[model samples]
Target: MRKLANRPGGPKGAAIIRRGWGKVLGGLTLSPLMAVLLTPPAAAQSADISQKVKAECAACHTETGNSIALPFPKLAGLAPDYLAKQLRDFVSGARKNEIMFPIASQLSRADITALADYFSRQKRTPAMVTKPQLLAAGEIVFHQGNKENGVPACAGCHTRNGAGAPRFPMLAAQNPDYVVQQLQNFRSGARTNDFGKLMRTTVSRLTDDEIQAVAQYIASVPPPAGR
Candidate 1:
C-alpha cells in the first residue's frame, strides 16, 4: 500500500495507509471472521448503538445523509472508510465544525466505522424540494466540466454513476448544507488532502448560488443502482 500525500478532499485523519490489501482479499483466503476483523467496520454492531447514533446524526445530518437544508449532504451511501475519516477529522480538528467536533469526539474509531458502514449501505432518497434555478445550473456543473475555470465534472472522480471508491465518499444523496460547507472548506484551503486539490479549485470559483445549486442537484440525485 502506498501513502498518498495530504491533498484536498482526501481522507483527513491520522496517516493510515489510504490503500490496503484488506479491501482485496477474497473468499477462503479471507474467512468471514477474518474479513470482519481485518476490514474496517462500515456500520454499528447493535441496534442500541445504531439507534443512538442515528438520533445523534439526525440533529445535523438528515436521515441517511440527507439534510433539511442546503449543504448538509445525505449520508445514506458514503464509503465507510471515508465516513470514518471525516469523523476522525472532526475529532482531531483537522476539519472544524462546532457541532460536528463535539459529537464525533464521543465516538471511538470503531464506532465511527460502524456508523459510516451502515450509512454507506443504505439507499439515498431525493430531497423533497429542488429549486429550479439551482437545479439547472447545478446540472450543468455536475455533468459538464468547466474547463476555462479548471473545474472537473463531479463525475470525473465520483464516477459516472456516483459509486465512490474506497476512501472516496459517496456524494449522490448528500445534504446540500454539508456539501456546501465541505466545498467552502476546499475553497478556503481548510479541507486539504483531496486528490490533486481538484475540489479546492472547483469550489473557489463558485458563487454562493452556484454552490447551493450544485449541492442541491447532487443531493437530489439518486445513488447508483446497487449502492
Candidate 2:
C-alpha cells in the first residue's frame, strides 16, 4: 500500500491546508475583539468635550453654543479657525469684550482648539425672522452687490448658503441684533480686527436699511435638516 506521507500532494499541500484553517479560525475569533478595542462609540468620543463646554461656556454661550441672548453670538457651526482667532483676539486685547477677555485669557491654546472643535460641530438654531418684507432686498445684497454703492455680494466670501470659509464666519441662523451690532462695529472702526479692513470697507457703503435687510435675511435661513 502507498504511504499517505509519500502521496503526490505531499507535506507542502498539508501545510497549506493547515494554514487556511488557521486563518479562518483567527478571523472568526479576532474580528469582534479588534472592533471593540479599536472603535469607540460617538457619544464616548464627545463626552469629554461636552463636559468642558458645560463647565466653562454654558453660562453665556449655552452648552450647544446656540445662545438666545442678543448680545452673545451663536457659536454653533462657526468656522473653527474663526472661533480660534476670535478667542486669541480676546486674549490679546484686539477684540474688547469684558466677558470674553477674562474667560479667554484663562484658556491655553489647546483649550481654545478643543472649544473651537466642539462648537464648530454643534448644529445652529435659526433665529426667527421678523422682517419678511426685507428678504428680497436682503437676498439681492447677499447674492449680488450694488454696483453703484461699490458693495460686494455677501455670498462672495460666505458661500451661497452662508456656510463660510476658514477665515470667514457663517452668518446663517445668526441673531439679527448681533449681526447688526457687528456690522455697525465694523463701520465705526470699533471692531478693527477684520483682515485688510475688508469688513469696514464693505459695511461703510451699506445704508441702515440695507444692514437691517441683510440681517433679517440671514436670521431667516433655515437650520440644516436633522440638525
Candidate with best TM-score:
2
TM-score, predicted candidate 2 vs. hidden true structure: 0.76
**Model 1 / residue 148 / CA error / Å:** 1.5
| CA lDDT, every model vs. true structure | 0.71, 0.85
The per-prediction CA RMSD against the true structure, in angstroms, equals: 16.4, 8.4
lDDT tens digits, residue span 118-142, model 2: 8888899878777889999998998
TM-score per prediction, in order, is: 0.69, 0.76
Worst 10 residues of 2 by lDDT: 1-10
The number of residue pairs in model 1 that clash at the backbone is 31
**Model 1 agreement with the true structure over 134-189: per-residue lDDT tens digits:** 78788778888567777678877776656777756777766666777888788889
